[model samples]
Target: MSAVLDIGSHKVVCLIGQQDSNMGVRIIGSGFGVSAGLKGGVVVDMDAAEVGIRTAVEKAERQAGMAIQSVSVNVSTRSLRSQQMEVHTEFASGEVADRDLTRVIESSLSELAQPEDAILHAIPLNFSVDGEDGIRDPRGMFGSKLGVDMHFVLAGIGPLRNLAHCVERCHLRIKSAHVSPYAAGLSVLTDDEKDLGVTVIDLGGGITTSAIFRDNRMVHVDAIPLGGQSITNDVARGLSTPMEAAERIKTIYGSALHGADDDYVNIPCPPMGAQDTLHHHPKSLLTSIVRSRTEEIFELLRDRMTDAGLDVYAGRRIVLTGGGAHLTGVREIAEQVFNKRVRIGRPNGVLGLPETIDGPDFAVATGILKAQFMDIDEAISGPPDLSGRRYRQRRYSGGPVGRSLQWLRDNF
Candidate 1:
């Protein structure tokens, strides 16, 4: 089993998992730690984030009775950036061999300039052999030259360095890193949504990450820095409650669809040891605060969708996942805005995962395990197949963060 860790703004989750021949993953153990030095899914204080990671990893190791040195992590701050690049290469030799083709593809990718942007990810989108598009792999195909399209996600340099440094300090080998929103997509997206078209909105505590998927490819990825955490902050200020109490109220009674009664809601506004409670009606509180912020977030998402010009069907769908998705009436709010069938998706297919960890919250971690299994199968799909590990070497240069399939894997 491979040990995977998800360093989230809310918590650090670790899991020991692996897949069988059936392409199904079985999680043997899991651990979590309170996040110390992170905000909105980005590491703001390096030392604190390292402490959180160490605590979580050590707990997972103890639970599994084994040591783990390497792990896959998720990145999901609004600071992340992505772009689609197409590179072309010419074959010096006429023969079609695997190494020759990989070199050409890798070299074509090497020309891709990584500016001030640190690499969030470098994923092979699709290959075009001699101008043919949509070729997943072209090992034996005859082509004098090859052209390829790759999707790369980059993060703001300063925030990214903080993350890398924090993980390094924890003594975890970064096998690969995945954008958090994209990682969420891997666990919850349905096949039909990917085949036709859909959007995934991971309503994280600090950021609302969005990705568009069509033709089984991730056409776009982006995020808004504001998320559920903002709402809680607003509640805390408006209701004059502690941040902890605001979070409690938001989780227990938050709703997106404001009603006339919302203005009449008398939230038990508790202050620092005061006998008289501040009586604020729910509607008055929501309209000026909660609804406004949620609408703003939805409008921002709408703007992003419009900018992408995605190929969507009439019943185009949206998958809502993450802690914010639990807010009442969230699906309805998203449906009206996107004009699509919206539903909450949960990660449902693991074998040994505990019930406590079985929910939309686990989507990114579940996707991480599933994605690794997919890469392994794809790597060994070529000819000269052997049942045992003796015949083939496990390729290390693989990661599971992209492709449109991520749209479903992410959100609830």
Candidate 2:
């Protein structure tokens, strides 16, 4: 059994489930609550965030008829980013051994500057032996020089500690932490899309995240602090409406592409104060505001993708996920700006979710559950020593030595 807690800027989702046959997870219980004490995916009020977390978890527990002691959470706050590190070593007079693989993977950690930021995911993209690339497993292969290309997802230590503390306050343990965009990609991306290369753009409330994947591994990840919330704020300020009414209008009448008769549709805008009366505005005006802001976001995304050196690797394909993806006509706008084929990403291969929460909004939580069953470290917890402690976590999965060491620890 496992639990997944997806803490976002707009909502907190908790899911309880168990691993079933064929490496699939069946969701038994799910709960979600309006997010509080968060701004742009970072917790601003620890107490408020803790309360929300406890409420969601308790709801799921009640539904599952079981208590959850720990959970896997998603991390997207504080500039979540990915970097590439390459390591090469020469073998002396023999075939490559498990120790050689371990050494090369360990050497890649040197790319990290310090302990203030931790690697959320260390994915071994590929291995090369004797200058021949694309070796899935390098063990027992004779090669004088072995090389590795490692992709790492990193997050700031302070934000990570704060997130961990919030979860602990609910009397729950964090089984593991995963990068948000990576988790979303895990749930929604198809095998063909991953193999051919694709980018996932998570249209979240407080942050818009982009992740590039190729050969079934995440190669790049970047985030822009602005997201759906920014658009809502723009609506509120532009129409002189309250936050609630602005959000309502954005959902009910907003569109990224204007229609021929949008001006004929007038949406009722509730008065700002109790004494004020109702006001109405042309729906076209509302959509125009949304379109302008969304365009800016898409343009910024284009710039970021190119700046990351991932423009070519992404291969002109994109998958949109998260709450903001629900906006009508967003796919068209994104396609125009990115010049790529764009489609909405929904969580697949999961069972037993209420129709209400089974959309792209919950992709991260669903992905976390999927991660647990698949043994994807991006889904499972890594070393548990990320709390600004002196203890360090080691990586061994890239080679046989690490696997043997882990097996001994488990069996001993």
Regions more than 4 Å wrong, model 1: 21-23, 92-100, 272-279, 311-315, 376-412
lDDT of 1 by residue, 108-206 (tens): 344543444555555666777778888877777887677667776667666666776788898777666666666677788877777687877888888
lDDT of 2 by residue, 1-412 (tens): 9999999998999999897787478999998877887887899999889878988998999999999898999987846878887778765646777777776776676545457777787888889997899887888888678898888887888788888888988898888887788889999999899989999888899998888989888889888898999999999988889999899899988899999998898888888889999998888888899999999988998998888777988986899999999999999999999999999999998888689877888889998888888855231145334653322344323368776675454334
Instruction: Give TM per candidate.
Output: 0.83, 0.91
lDDT of each candidate versus the true structure: 0.70, 0.84
Candidate 1 C-alpha RMSD relative to the actual structure: 9.5
- Residue clash pairs of candidate 2: none
Measured over all alpha carbons after superposition, the RMSD of each candidate to the real structure, in angstroms, is 9.5, 4.7
